[model samples]
Every structure is written in structure tokens, then in C-alpha cells.
Target: MPIKQSGKRLRVPWRKKLDENGLPLTLPTYMAYCAVAGALRPWNRLGAKTIVTLVTTDDFYFPLFAEAARYFSSQIWHPQRYHGNVLQCSDKNFRHEAEALRDERAILFASPSYQIQEDDRLLSDAVVSLGPRSARHAEAALRRAGLPITNESVELLLTEPWSRLSRAFQDRRDALQAIQRLRSLPKAIPPAASEAESPPSTPDPTLSDMHGFGSSLIEWGYDLAKDIADYKAGIIPWRDVENGVLISGPPGVGKTMFARVLANTCKVPIIYGSASRWQEAGALDEHLKAMRASFDESREKAPSILFIDEIDVFGNRGETDRHSAYMRAVITALLQLLDGFERRKGVVVLGACNYPDLLDSAIKRPGRLDRHIAVPLPDAAARRSILKRHSGVTLCSADYEVFDMATEGMSGADIERLVRDARRAARRQSERLNSLHILDNLRPLVKLPSAYVHSLAVHEAGHALVSHEVGYANVADIKISRWRVEGEYRALGCVEYDVGADRPRTRTFFENAIAVCLAGIAAEIEVFGSFSQGAAGDDAADLNRATELATAMVGAFGMGHTLAVEKFSPNAFARMRSSNPELRREIHNVLETELERAKSIIRLQRAAHQALVTRLVDVDQISGAEVAEIIRNHRRPTVSLAKPERRAAR
Candidate 1:
């Protein structure tokens, strides 16, 4: 049938064929149908029990094409013969529903390659695979329907996936547009299993050179490396070697890096795998197949490490939901593999994830990913070592003192980025790497380290000092940095302080927060004689934040003069602040009162604040212990603070 488009009549052959066969296919199956047509194009016919195995660039295509082959076969020549009852040979129930493939007539086999049989003997003739060409035919059919896509895209399409492409087509999306979207989707199929093993880290900085994996983690890594060597040398039995380990931590803490380091230390190859990778292979069955293949591959490459980066994704059977049965099966299958993994000689398994709590209990049981080690954010000493290695420069004691302050609470990965950014910035200036570069990179705005260092110190110090004076927990310390860790947010400085976690957040609690938020500008005004506009930039600005908090207190908490309720959230304030002039006035009054309150504290703690500014300017960072010591040295005269009245808060 002819269909009229924008100007001309168009005949889409694939559409005509689907109409003729009463076939319905989503985009994936349609692509699969195209692959089948391409596979059968060379052959005059698909001979009986035609056992052929071919590889696709991405495993995602196999199952979908298998279904497509069934559909296309059903609609083609000898359609009756193709019925399950008559032929009854399929990996699937190929031609029909469950009952259709009766036990009596069924013949099933799997082959790694194509073969067609004549007489009693099987004959084989290899043909070009059902790959790019088939996809090209599918594109041609779409082009016939007045939709043309690139050959390169078709080739790339054959190489990878379209979970997104298929879903996009669910709402009558154009076939060309759907396939083209794959150009931007994050690899629908990750690299092959072997490619999954990151190419060996170069000698420049193998994981061995890296620091910040806690001593326990470092000890386990070396022990495992030694065990692998001893096992290979016949000095120890497989049982004597640690069966497996599960390294857990937050992201950017270098859980995966530890595995690579272990492999390097062991002098063995490492193969990385994860449940998510297997899932990308296609459906449940294909996922299992890919997973099993990874195990086999690890065994093939003995004395190897199989790192499962997302071991937590394999949720055990007990945690089943309607949608989780597939994952349940995955978890069950993984458990079976991990159980058997212990017996695989010369092979070790390691699992990593941000949330180990979400992992199957069985996976972390006695013989599986058992030896759990947490990779915490590096400590001050570890950060120093990491910075020294990554900064690629010499540092004096003073530089390190400042760096220790800057790098507090940073993960190994964060340190890595800081060093990288610092180097890049210094490189652009054609200067040798220095503390300035390192500090600047740590906080993106540390560019004017000499000029702005004291101000950022003053700002963050204000937060900490007020956090202290506001009857919150004593601040531990604060840091400023130039080095930027890749995954960490780009920033100049952050205050490391905490009130008691279990402390109740009453009206006083919020009021205290408002004071801390405003303290930076207040401190600036008290000492520097004026506040810089830097006190208010971005939504995180001290002034902006104080305003948001004050609005919440006045309008939502009903802590102000009036008891009228109003919507309260950070950005939700502008309307209420605008419409209710009384609310606006009360908010302003609260901010003013808090500013005055913070200034008074700053005034009393002038000696301490000045000392803090001097210390911060000298090092560009300081720890809570230091902050505490400084504040204690310049203690304020005893005075009573106004008690906050009880008020309901949002």
C-alpha cells in the first residue's frame, strides 16, 4: 500500500511486510527482525534445525534476534512446518506457546557456529554474519518509508544497544531518530569482559604508588598478592589463600583502584565484572550466560583477580519484589558462582560497592566475598602522603601543614583530582608546581591564594567559631585547598564542625544555624572594617542562606512576632516575603538581630578572631583542634546568652 507523506507517496517495504505477516515489533525486535532477514538473505532457505552461532558486537542483540528469527520464520515459507508441533526444535519453544512444543517431537542443541544438514550427515558452509549488513537492510526499509539513517549509524547500531531506542519508539518515535539517539546514550553495552579489565596501569603510577587505602586494606592487598604468588609456587593450598574479599566504601574512595593495585601487586591479570555489566548483555538468560563466561574467563587466566565493582546489585532471593525476580535470579546465580569461586585454583574474587548493606547477606557469607575491608576517606597523614605523591612537587613542612588543613575529609580519589587540577593549572602558567597551585585546585576559587586566602579563612572560620559559640559541638578544624578532586565538588574551603548528632533541633537549633550562616559577613565587618560582596554569591552565599533560614523561622516556624503560617523552603520564600510585608519585616528583623548577635560575639572574641585570621592566612587552612585551641587561648569574658523560646518548626 502507498502512503502519502509531506509531498510524495512512499512505500515502506518492511512496513508492508509487517502488515502482510500481521506482525508487531518494538524497535529492538524490529532491528532483530532486520538481522534475521540479513542472516537468511544468503541462504535460499533456513534448513531444519539450522544450528548456527554468531557473535554480535554487543550481546544485547542475540535474544531479541532469536525472537525476531522466530517471528520472521513463522511468517515466511513453509510456515506450517515452522510450527512448534511439527518441527519442535528450539532453544526457546521457538514456534509456539509452551504446549505447542510437545516433548515427543522436540530436538534441541546449541552450536557455536552455522551448519546446515543434508541426508544423515551435517554439512557446514559459513556465510557473512547477521551483522551490519542486516542492519543496513533494516535501514533501507526505513529509508523506503521516507526515513533515511546513516550507514555508519547502522554499523554502530549493530555494534551496540537500544534499550533507549526501543523505549523511545514505544510512543511512535521515528526509527531514524531512535537509532541516532544511541550516539549520545552512555554505552548501552559496556566493553567486552576482557576490555572490562582496565588496560594495565602504566608504570608511571600503578596503584602501588597510590596511598590512602587504610593500613588494613594495604595489608590485605599485599597478603593476597603474596598468597597468589605462593599458591602459584605450590607453597600453599587454595584453602590457605584467602578465598575472597569484599571492599566496601563510598564512591570516589577508590574501591576499584584497590583491585587494580592488588592485581599489579600480585603480578597477575585482573578481570572486572559486575551484575550491571551482565544485565547489559540482554535479558535474564543472556545475563547469566555472560556472567558464567566471566567466571570461565577468570579461570582461564589463572592467578587472576575478578573484581565485581557493583556486587551489591545482586539482591538475594529473600528480597524479592514483582520487578526484582530477575535480580533475585541474578543474585542466586552469583551466589552459586561465588560459592564455586572459592574452589577455582589460582583465582581470587573481590567485590566493591558504595552500599554493602544493600548486598545479599549470602554474598558476604563465609566463603564468598567474605573478607570485608572498608576504604574510608583518607586521614590527615594519608592525605599528606597522597598529596605529596599526586602534587608531583616538593613540599616543605609549612606547605604540608596547610595541605593537611586543606585535605581533611578527602577520599583518595579526591586527592587525585586535586593534584591533577593543580598540575594542570600550574602547567598552563609554565611554573613549577607549588602550594599555591595545590591549594587553588583544592578549592576552585583558590586562584588568588595570597589575596583571598585570609578572606576564605575568615569566612569558614566564622562558621566554625560561631558554630562553637552557638553552643554547638566544637568544630574539629577547617581546610582550604587548590587541588580539585575530580568527583568532589569544586570549592575553595569548607568548615569541618559538628554539633552533637543526637541534639534536638528546636527553635534555638534553627536560630543558631541562622547565626552561623551570617557570622562570616559579620566577622568580616567586625575585623576587616567592611564585608566583601563575596559574602553573597551563588545561592550558597552567607547572606542568601541566612535570608532563607530567617524566612523559614519567621514564616514557617512562627518564631517571629506573628503566628500566621506561610510556605517555607529555601527558594519558596520570595513570594511569602513579597506578599506579606509583615512577614518580610520580621524576617529582616531576625537577620538583623542575628547579625548583631554574631557581631557581638566577634567583638568579644576579637583577639581569637584575629589570631584565627592570622593562622588561616599563614596556612590557608586549619583543623578544628587548632580552632578550639585558638578560641580557648582568647576566651571571651563570661556572659549570659538569651534563651530561645520554644516554637513549632517545619
Candidate 2:
């Protein structure tokens, strides 16, 4: 029967190369067989005046040689065969038979198992055999075949001696043709409009000239910049070199851009791909093609980096049969390629995702994803940096306070938008920009009411107070607005808290949890004598998170000293979002207990709370400076008598 032939295969065990019998069969194996067949072409085409023996000592290689001979005879040119012209001799008799045929012109293909010596009678016309081991074997074989070569060039010779030369010639010819075609092309038509008739001209010096990062929270972004710099310096040794990294953060946090910057800093060619592009059925296959193309492109330009943005879309944790099978195939192909890292040099893989937990476990394992970096919201320092970078304003003082209170929970993108809106407002106001214009533009940032603002303030302040008082969270800033602007989201208050550098540690402090959650509502009740829905969302989230943590501590972790019950249930958030009668009753019970505890704490600091609220209501927008002044003048020392003394700390 004719030898079956198709695409290339390799005997890579990891890739399921061999059959159940452990026989030699794979794309690489087939390709190698074809390679040998081509190598025998010179002799096959010469019409065989003398016997040329192709011998393989390794049993694994017998099938490969036989296939090669058969393929060559059927697919390529065939030579006249004498009685022993095309012989597959055993290793024991390979040397003796070759010596007997020394007088005749012939080709001998034998494994490295047969050593080559200068005095060996048949050395002149012998070509050494090679298995799927080292390229050096091919080099030695070529040398024995009277074509001395190096390992570097052996791949080309063994794979395609004539094809390589042909490819180079074709490339040169195509390049010349392209240049000639370009030269022959017609010139572009000039703009016929006169200067007066043309649209107003504006000089664009740089692509980024008009496209700045905008009023970003530069101070908050300082740490991010440092992290980026550290990344550039390769300071953070990736925990797993084999597995790619997962970068998760809020939207518009420059995740993709960060990948690009890292790639550029490393001076590596980026194979930038997106999961969105591969969402369709056959899209992943096309992506694989592009990936292969990128490798080729990288070969021409080494040190390649493949940046996959929104990687979760491709590697989502789901059954393999669900979604596109092509996607799974693509992932499998990528895994195969990744596993080939030992053979593939200078290729780095980077994957970015906002929902990293949604990624498949197989993709995230060591030697696959290995690294998971949480690019969280920008801190105060980072916010300031982002603002400085994006904002065009050059404040008189380096310690300007506009960003200190304006930005809290805002992401880098949010800060940038604030800057952009401010700039646009300034431009519309006709002429030189001032800080007031920016402030005015930022006034209606959150589209909320005064009642909401007051409620949020109380809520956020509550969080800050309890967090600080309980000694779990360090207070950074508390404001009832967008992190990028003061008096921003009137209904939405944000309290910036530093949970400290001790990570992989539980964040929720049980002592502070209930009080922190009830602070907003308490403040609202204190001022308005009634509660508003302003702090509803935040309260629910915080309460749910705290309760879940506490429950987990009691149940899953067995950390609770008293309640050692292991409560296993999927409805963790059932107590939070549910409005069912029984659930609401349970929630109220839970909340009231916490609220009473919070009330007791606040009662102890009633005077301080009253003074702070009064100051906030009067000021409308209070700086950290003003807060400090108020705290110094009105805050009492007795409220903190129960707490420990301050110590030297970061």
C-alpha cells in the first residue's frame, strides 16, 4: 500500500506522538522521514551505477528509513537498483559489507553507532545516520558524507538545502520587485485649498501631544510608576518562568499598555493578541496562524514577547466541550508550543486579564501561568503621579492639595477622564486656564445630592474612624465624592484605607467590622434623624464581606475561638442581597447588634463627632490640612484612652 502522508508530526511524547504500541509515529517523525528521503535524493536521481546502502542500527529508526525510501521512490525520483543496491543491512554486518563495496561508487547511511575513522576504507562516500537526538549527529553524518558542516547550519541542510537558497533568492527578488513597484506608483495629489480656504491649522508635534493621559491621579499613580520601573528592571523575578503572568485590575488601568511598555522595555518584539479577536469559532485557529507568523517574524527579529490581552476570554474556566472547540484546540496548540520552550529560545509569554479567577486551572498552573499579579486601584501616591503626568497645570507648589482629597477610589483611567473634562472645560471657557475651572468642572462629578453627600461623608468617616480606632486599617482619606474630585459623587463616599504591607493575611478586623459598616448610617442618623439609601450599597457590600469573612473564620478556617461550626453553603451573599422576610430579619438582627456596638463607640466620642460633622457641613470641601486643624482643636484625647499608644511605624 502507498505510504500515508499529510501534515508534519513529531515524536514528542508529551504531545502524544507515539501510538499505544509505543511505535514511531508523529508529525516530527514523518518530517524526519521525509528529510531522510530528500537526503537520499542525490543518489536516487543519479540512477544508481553502484549500490548505496542506508542502514539504521537503532530499531526505532528502521521504520523511519523504510518509510523514507518508500516515500522517495514513490514521490520523488527513483534509481536503478542492482541486487544489493538498496539494502537495509544489520549493524553487525554494516561495516564489513561497506568495505566489500568500497571499490564501487555508492552512498552509505549508517547510525553514529558506527564510528567514522580516517582509515575506514568506505569513509570517502559514507553518510552517517541520525536519530531524533542531537543535530551534531547530522553534522557528523554530513562530514562523513564529505560535506563538512556546523550544527547551526545542519538544520537548514537536513531540512532544506536547496529550499533555503531558493527562499533567500525569492526574498531578495520579491523585495526588489516591491521597491520597483513602489517607485513606479503615482504620487499623491497635493491639497489644492489655499491657506485661507483650508481648515484652521494646528501643529501636532507628537502623536501624544493632543492625547495626554489627562487629569489622572498622579500622586496615586506614583507606586504604579515605580512598579512599572521595577518591572522594566526585571526586579520582580516571576515566580514561575514557565507559566505566563495574569495582570488583573479595574478597567482602564492601562493593563494592555503596561504589557506593551514591559515588552518595549525588554527590547523584545511583541506578539500582541487579544481574546476578543479569537471569540469566533475559527478565530483561534487564525490566532494560532498569527502566532506562528509572529515566531517567524521574531526569528528575523529575536527576543519575542507574546502579549495576550483579556486572556480570560480565551482561557475561561469551563467545560472543554462548551464554547468553541477551536478555542480549546488553540489553547492546546499554545500549550504544545509553550511546552516546546526548551527547544524554542527567546520567547516570553504575557497574559493580561481583569477577571483572572475566571481563568482555567490548567492554564494558571506552575510552568503555565505561574505568576498572578493583582494590579489593584492606584494608591494616593500613584494618584498624584497620574494627575501630574496627565494634568497640564503646573501648580505653584509641588505640595499642592488638589489631588490629595479629590482622588480616592478612582482608577488611573478615571483620573485621566477627570483631567480631560477639566481641560475641555478650560478650552470652552475661552483662554488661559485656571485651577478654578478644573474645580468647577469637577463639581458635578458624581451627580448626587447634598443629603446623599452628607450621608456618604458620615458613612465614609465611620469606616475611617472604626478602621483607625480598631487598629486594623490605616486611614488615608475619607471623602464623599469621586476619588479624582472633591464634592464629586455626592451619594457615594469612599474611605481610603491601607490594610498594611502584611499580605496573605486576613483583611477584616472582627472588632472593627460592625462599627465600620454602621458608621455611615450612624452619622446619617445623627445629623438627619433618619437613614437614607445613599450608603445602602456600600453598607451591604461591607456587611456581606465582613460577615462572610467572620463566618469563614468560624467555619472554614476554624479560627473562631468560640463558634467552631463549619458552615458550608454556596449562598454566602444570601444574607446581604436577599430581601426575603426571614433574611431581612436576620440581616436587621446582625446589623442592629453591630450598630449598637458602633453607637457605644461614637457616644464616647460624641463631642468630637459633632465637631467634625459641623466643620464638614460648613466647609463643603475640607482638605487634609483643614481636617488636621479641626482634629487638633476639637478632637479629645479621652476617646482613645482605651486604645494602645502610637508606636514608631510606617
Candidate 3:
């Protein structure tokens, strides 16, 4: 049957808007739909009228035609195939068919490319027009009912179109596309088992030239001379000769600089790269290939160091080892290659990571990173030396008394930062190179050192006295103010007590342990009638540690002896991490018990406590001689009642 239009006599329904690629050429489609719809509205006055239509082409107008049909619900114009509405041969056939239907008051909406003679065509008032074509007349033939379009409006519609999906939906689609792309790549090949060998160090293991490198490692109390001496004598254990050495430590301990020193000492070139860079840009395989190439390139220069910085992330993320498959494969390949190279001829592999705990076991086994040496924060003497090196000033013998006490508990990096800040201040103030600049730089407005020193001494002294009296820890020399170590604080005072060889397990001993930990605070409270914030950080740390051990004894270690409950080692720190509700109560109760016990003990030993505080405050910096004098003058033996033990603490 011939195509039918609405009873209102509108132009043909536009159904062909999409081009070959499924994109819409919207301008012509809009014009066709608008003209046909507008013309057919007169038919809708009676009721909804149906239209029949056909579209021959699928370029520029396809989407618009479909959209209009859906919007108008034109039932009569059910164009199942492309040729129903448009007869492509000539405009005359199309116009004659339209005239044949003119008596029925139906309009035929044909493509704009078709032409009809005026006699055959309906009068302008009888037929509804979609709109004029914006582009070539070839595109103007297509029309739809109930719309009109100008050139600018058509261009605007064609230029800017809308997508059905939302932004979030688009992202999900993109991710799916990427995943599909990844699945298409070939599987990576695994390396053979026999390719593992250690890299070779230089003939002169200790390169004395390190003295001139001007790096922070040398000045930060790294003990270069000692490391060099040990290496020269072969006293230092060479770990992971096959894979590489993995150095682990917390941040700001100079790990990177230390790695550089090791490379220079062994006379090797440093090849630095981070394992994380590979995870981005879908470039893991490429990164592995580059790593292998790096080994080959550096081998020619023998004794070069392949430093894989942050190797923990390089491990396979989801394999049996919990690392990525590619990462594990790369690590395996690296280890095998390292093992295969007979003599590094001068190549060494060194790896650095702050998180050694997260590393794969394979990396730390005999063939990989075998030696684990802890690079701790600096001690007091090291801190003093570090200050001298960075500040470019030496402490006088007179100031050593004060200088040594001021730097306790400090790290190497801390010392360097302090020195740098001191120098900057000097430069700012236009002062000559002097020690006062350093003092001014390091001195906080709170003056924590002196107050902290006195408090620590008294605190430590309380621990000694209480431990001796209660028969727990042995009393050490009870040095009033020794500040030669890293992070030294001038204390009100601290007493040195031997924590004993065995980990105390008995209830009384545990109580004593609490007492000993609380002794410093007890001493502070006794002398000052209040505690200083100087002890706040240390007290919290010590309290938490002691509480953990105590809780473990009660809950997990089966030391409670009364509870008789199933022993389970609940990690206090981990529990805290998980935000367990009971932790606050349990920890608080334990601290309170210990604090009350400590207060009572100090009250009983009130006289001796007073004498110790008086002497400590008078001297500001007490020596062994002064401690002994105070001990004699007070008629109390300097030695604790209990004999001291010689065990080292963990």
C-alpha cells in the first residue's frame, strides 16, 4: 500500500536520521519531524490520527526520525522498511502519489531531495512544511510532522547532541573497556630457576673517598668509618648477593643517603627506580622489561648497583604471595638473573623499603635480601656529633654538660634539621658563626630541656628506688642528667633500673613493673606537687606499652592465674586500630591501679624522695660524685636494696 499521512494532512514522518556510523545528522531530521507534526496537529483536533511512512536512507537523519516517531506515536506511519515513505526514483512519482491522497486530506512527507510540479503538489496552505534546509537541498527532502527549524537552530542541534548515559555510567563503561583490553594481552612468560647469582663488590671495599662526598649520611652519625672498616675486613655479612640487599627503616632515618654511601663504598653506580611507577599507565610489563635491560646495560660497567627503591609494592598483589602476578614474576626474574651472573664483575643490587614487614618472604629468603639490620634513630652522643657536623660548630667542654642533656631521644634527621634551622637563624640575624645561634634555634619557648631533665631524673630515680624497695628491677647508677644520647631531655630526673633478664610474669612482679613505669611520674608529682607536660609524650608511650603487656598477661599470656580463661593474644594496638570499645576502660583501669600504687610507695619513702629532689634541683646537672654525696649525706646507700641484673632489654 502507499505511505499514509495523518488525517490532518502533515508531511511524511522522518525516520531516517542516523548516518552509517550510527551518528545522527540532526538538523535535517529535526526539520522533517517538526514540519510533519505541525501539519498533522489539525487531525489531532478530532482525535489521535495515525500516519504511514518510509525512510530510504540512514545518513544524518536516522536518530531524529526514530525519536520523532516515538514522541508522536504515529500509528498509521508504521515504516517497517526504509523505502515505505520515500520513493527515490523521482519527485514526480512522489508528488502524484501525494495528489492521489489529497482528496483523503493526507500528506506525503518525502525526502527534501525529491521535487514535485506545482499542479501535482498541494497548495502551500494545504500541506504543512517542516522547515527550510540549512545545508544542501539534497538533505532538505526529509520531513516530519509538527516542527520548524531555521538554519542556525539546525546547525546548533547538529553540532551539540546529548548521550543517553550519565557521567558515572560512562566511567563504568570505560573501565569495562579497559579490563577487556587487559584480558586480550598475552600471558607473561615465567623465568627459569637457575638464573640466580650474587653481584660482585670492588677490590677496595671501603672507598676512602667517601669522606669528601658531602652527603648527609656521613654527617648524620652513620658511622661511615666503622661500616668501611667492617666491609674491608669482611666482617659485615653480605646478604642477598644473588638478588640484592634490602634496607628497611622508618622515614627520616637517612635510608636513601645510606644506600648511596653503600654504593659509593663498594664503588658501584646507583641505578635508582621506584617500583610504584610501573603500576600506572598499564605499563607493568614494560617496566619489567626496562628493569631487565637496565641490568644488562649496567653489567658492562661492572660493579654497578641496581637499586630498586621501594620493592615492597613490586611484589605480586594477588598471587599466593599476595603481590601482583607481574610484580612477582619480575621479582623472580630479577632474582634468577642476579643468581645467574657468575661474578657481578662489579655490579651489586641494593633495594630500599620502609615497610619490610609487607615484603614477600621470597625477597627476604637466603637467595634474596638475607640480612635485616635495623637502622635506628640516633643515640645521644651521635646526636651531639651530628649537631657539630651540620652546625659547623663544636661544643665547648663547659657546654657539653648542657648540650649532651638537650638532645636525648632525637633522630639523626632531627639533628640535621635542627642544625639547618640554627644556621638559617644565624644568617637571618647577621650573627657570626657561634654556638648561641644553635641554642637559640633549638630552644623552644617552653624550655622543656631543663624541666624535662629534672623530671626524668626524679622519675628514673623513683623507678630505681621503688624497684629496689619492692625487689623487682636492679638500680643502675641513677645518673641525674646524662644527655649524650639521641633525644635527651633535661629531666627533673630519671632513675636507671635494670629491667632484669627474664620478662616478669608474676602478678607482684607485673605490679612492680607498673610501679617502675609510674615511678618517674610519681617522683614528679612528689617534688613539684604536680606533673609537667614535659613527661606527657614519654608517659603516654610508656603507659600504653606497659598496659599492653599487662593486658596480654591477663587476657592472652595466661599469667592471670585467676581468670583461667582461654588465652588469646589480642593485640592492643590492633584492637585500638579496630576501635574496640573496651580498650579505653581496660587501659585506664590498669594505669590507675599502677599510679595509685606508685603514689602510695612514694608517700612511704617521702624523706628519701625529698632528699633526691632537693639535690637534683640544686645541681641542675648532677654527676656521679654529687649523687654519691647526696646518697651519703641523706644516710641512704647509693645502691638499691636489691642487687642489679645485667640483662639487655629488647
Candidate 4:
């Protein structure tokens, strides 16, 4: 048979290099293969006289480098002469061999730790540097090689002598022996206490010790705390414990603080990792390595809490195309660590993210981060508690309530900032921190643009009027405060209402709610010549809610044009719109009808609306009772005078 040539050279981008199972290839192996293929190229564009390359890799991955060189030579280089072409030499004789090679393809793989003596030939244009493998690199390598080594495995490989021996020898018997030795290690003994020693007097704060959590949340925290206590007391096995929790909410809702408090309550040490810290390490590969190192550290300190902050960095895929592949691979590595081969017993992984919707579903699946706890923005009572906790001694119960009322729609962090600002103001004035100081500092922070105050008053007054007219008894309070702005949307004002317990709500109730929702926009248009985007956020939310309500009424509740209930998904309106176009039209029609009803109601209660708007603009806020009183006082005349003669005849 004639000698067969390998034909054109095969090249892979460093980022796209993968193993058979589609995971990222280890950095050393990837570098070695790329170097070998480059050296074997028919044309040496880099001005190299010889087709030989020197590659430096980590000591631990030296074997993988050799394996990669051989595999690439067979698959890419000339198959018949690959045996003679590929060479793995130590640094001891690398200098002489590299200088002597001429018109021959060769690859010299050496450990990065090896210090090669200065040689002219060794300092050639074909020197490739593959630095030492990191925890991330090892993970990528093991995954590419179809081995089941993870961060936990790395921890065991480092800590357990038998496990290390097993990995070194690649034998299960050695691994079993290592496990036996780990079990046989001697336990430590505590020193005897003196007679004067006494037990601690104070009660330790556990999950139950945490404040600001709701009754249900407190119960949940108590259960977790109890579980940890029981586990420590040897009353329960580690397997019976929940593995992890996912805390999600808006920023400054104390998600991070909650994690710290939970760890303290559980009496376990916490390992903190932030996504930005990992990204700061530079390349995606380095970021993965850092992330894996964090997990490994948590595993090493077993019976600990691992808190990964701002985890939404590994969000759902397909959001971007620029670095989609790189990001997806990173997420894959994270998923592997989260629900990998190892079953972590004592370690509890807690992740906190503001954008939970953006996170990958795989991360939230069972056996990984299964428990989801929402840390909501503090309510009035919670806000009061938070203010009292953060405020100086100058603030009393009355000041707390006033601060709480003023901080409506503000997060716990926002309140903390306000109190901090107040303290600074008091210190600057050399006086006690009082309500006046707080109010003065808070006014500037919560002040709205002068032009928008009237518009906001009109908007909130409209919602209050419509809600009251519709007999929605849960209406609590309405305010025109510029406390916080969410994303790109500015909050001019808001109307607070309670739905009054969970129950099967009717279509009439939904329609009434939709009317109240549109009342803000309607009121703005009625008062101002034209409505502004101040209600844009509310407009979007109301439209979505109306569409959902209309869809449910037609498809699920059978309360539409035809009383025929149909089984459909929640998003069926968009998917089945072409076949049943009326579904969308009816939804729009419902919203339009509600809008017109709101306009008519505002028109009928025009005097009352004006009174409410005036009070809101002047006073900045009004209680639900004040709103009802104004409406009651400005009631429109029910008896019309258009047919007075007919009434006299009767």
C-alpha cells in the first residue's frame, strides 16, 4: 500500500475545543494539541526553519499533554510517520534534541515547573506555553477525558491520603484503602475545663432569632435551624437535611444579610463567593477555576454554608450571541458542581439573586438548589422594625412610625440609608438625631420633580376614586411619594391596596381590578391635556393582567362569549392567536371597555376626584378613609331635573 498523507491540517479555536461528550477540553491538552498541529503545518508562516515545537504544561497534566500530542499526530499529522514525529522529552535533554532536529516534525512536552537551561534553539519562534492547571483546568480536563472528578473529588484527592494514592495509581483498590485510612484517623480530645469555668449566659441567635421575616418565613427558618441543631446533636442523619436554598428578591431586601444570619443561627461557618469576583479574574477559564475553588473550599469545610451572591450571572441561555458559547460552557461547569457526581451531606448551598427569572432552570432543579425563598420588600411594620433597629437612640416609637410612613415603597436598604443620612445630618448640626433631621434629609431624597407632582397626584387620585367606586373594600392607602425608581421606570406615585385573603376571584372582580388599574392613566388624561409616561409601568402591568384575566375567562373559566371551557396553556393566547384571533381581540376589547368605564366614573365623580387630587398635591399623601370622605362629601346629584314635568304629573 502507498503511504497515505494526512492532507490539510485541522485547526480548532481554543474556546471551541471540546471532548467527545461536548465539554470544554482541559487547557494543557488543548494547548499541546494546538502546538503540535501548528508545528506540523506544511507552511511555517512564522519564519521557523524547523517543524518542531516546545510546549510547557502543568506537572499533573503532563500525561494528558503526551496523550493529546499522540492523538493529534495520528488524526491530523501523517498517520504512517506519526510514531517517529511526535516526541515527549524531559527538560533535562530537551535543549540538545530541539537544536539537532531539522526537516523533522517534533513536539517536546515539559512540565512548567521544569527550569530549562538557556539554549538558542529552545528560545525559537515555536515555543508554546501552557501554564499550570488550576482547579477549573483540572475540572475541564477530567470532564473532557470522561472522568467523573469534580470539586468535591479534588477536595478528597487533596485531603484523603488513600484517595490521593488511588488517583495517583488510577486504582479502585487504592481508593478503598484511602477511605479506610480516613475512617481510621484518630479523633481529637478537648482539654478538661477548670472549676471556675461557666456556661455562656446569653442565648445564641439561630434562624428563630432572625427578625423582619414573616410568620411563615420565621417558621421555615425555625425548621431549618432545628434541622441543623438536630444534625449536630446526632439525632438525624445528614442525608435527611435539605441541601440548598435559593433566596430571590429585589436588591437591598437583605438577601445577603439573611444568608449571614442563617449561618449564624445554624452555628455553621459560611463561605462567600460573588460572581463579579470570579469574573474579575479575567478570562472565562479563570472564572470557572475560581468558582470551582470556592465550591471545593466549602466542601473541605463540610457542615458549612456556601453562599453564592448575585448568581444571575449564570442566567438562562440564548440572551446574547457574542459570548454565548463561552457563557453556556461556564453555566455547564456550574451545573456540574451544583448537582455533580458527589452527594454533599453537611454543606448547604445558598444562592442569592435579584433576577431569579434570568437564572438557568437547571440550577433550580431538585437535588441542587431546590428550595426557593422570596425575601420581599419590607412592609410597613417590617419597615418600622428596620428603622428602629438602624436608628440612633434619639428616634422613638413615634419617629419610627413616621419614618415608616414616609418610607413607603422603599426597601430595607433604602431605609437604612435614610437613617444613616439623618444621623450624619444630626452630627453635622451637633444636636440629637431627631424627626426633624430625618425629615429634612428624607425630603430631598424622596422629592419628585415639581412638574410631576400634580400629575402624580391626579394619577393616584384616579386609582383611589375608581377602586372605591367599584366597592373594593381592601383599599388601604394612597400616596404621591417619589421614594424609589425601578429600572428605567420612574415611580411618580402609587396606590396601596390589599386583596384581602386568597380566594377564587371572579371575572367581575378581575374586570373591576382592571378598571382600577386603568383609572390612573384615565385620570392623568382627564386632568392633564395628555398623559405622560409616568404611568407607563402601570400601563404595561395592567395590560398584561387584563390579557391574562381575559384569557382565563375565555379559555379556562368559560366566562367569555361562549361558556365552553377549553384546556389550554397559560401562554396559549399568543400560541393559538392565529387559529382563534378573537381571543386577542376580546382581550383588548375588555381593557378598552374598562378604560371607558374608568373615564366615565372619573367624570361622574369629577368634583370628588378634584378634591382628592388637591389634597394629595398639597399634603403629599391621604389615608383611604380621607379619600372616601372626600368622595362622600362631593357625591353627584342622583335625581335629574330633565323630566320634572312628568314627575309632577305622577
In order, what is each prediction's RMSD in angstroms?
Answer: 22.9, 30.5, 25.9, 25.4
Q: How high is the CA lDDT of each candidate model?
A: 0.67, 0.50, 0.52, 0.65
- How high is the lDDT of residue 468 in model 1? 80
TM-score of 1: 0.45
Model 1: lDDT to the true structure: 0.67
Candidate 1 vs 4: which has more lDDT: 1
Runs of candidate 2 with Cα error greater than 4 angstroms are 1-243, 275-287, 316-324, 377-474, 480-491, 496-511, 538-571, 575-587, 614-650
Task: List the candidates ranked by lDDT, beginning with the highest.
Answer: 1, 4, 3, 2
lDDT of 2 at 621: 47
Which segments of candidate 1 are over 4 A away from where they belong?
A: 1-210, 214-253, 260-271, 276-284, 293-306, 310-350, 353-384, 387-394, 397-451, 478-490, 527-530, 536-593, 619-638, 642-650
> Per-residue lDDT for 291-336 in model 4, tens only?
8888898889878889999999887776687888888888888888
Window of ten residues with lowest summed lDDT in model 1: 4-13
lDDT tens digits, residue span 333-371, model 3 = 666666655544345566777788887776677655675
Considering summed lDDT, which 10 consecutive residues are worst modelled in model 3?
Answer: 160-169
After the best TM-score superposition of candidate 2, give how far the Cα of residue 210 lies from its true spot, in angstroms.
16
Model 2: per-residue Cα lDDT over 377-475, one tens digit each = 776666666766666565444234445455566777887787777765543332234666556654333334666555556656555555555554445
Indicate which candidate wins on lDDT: 1
- The digit string of per-residue lDDT tens for model 1 on 429-538 reads 43446878886765322235465767777777777777788776768767765444444444466786676788675668777888888888888888788898866766
Worst 10 residues of 4 by lDDT: 640-649
User: What TM-score does each of the candidates earn?
Assistant: 0.45, 0.49, 0.51, 0.50
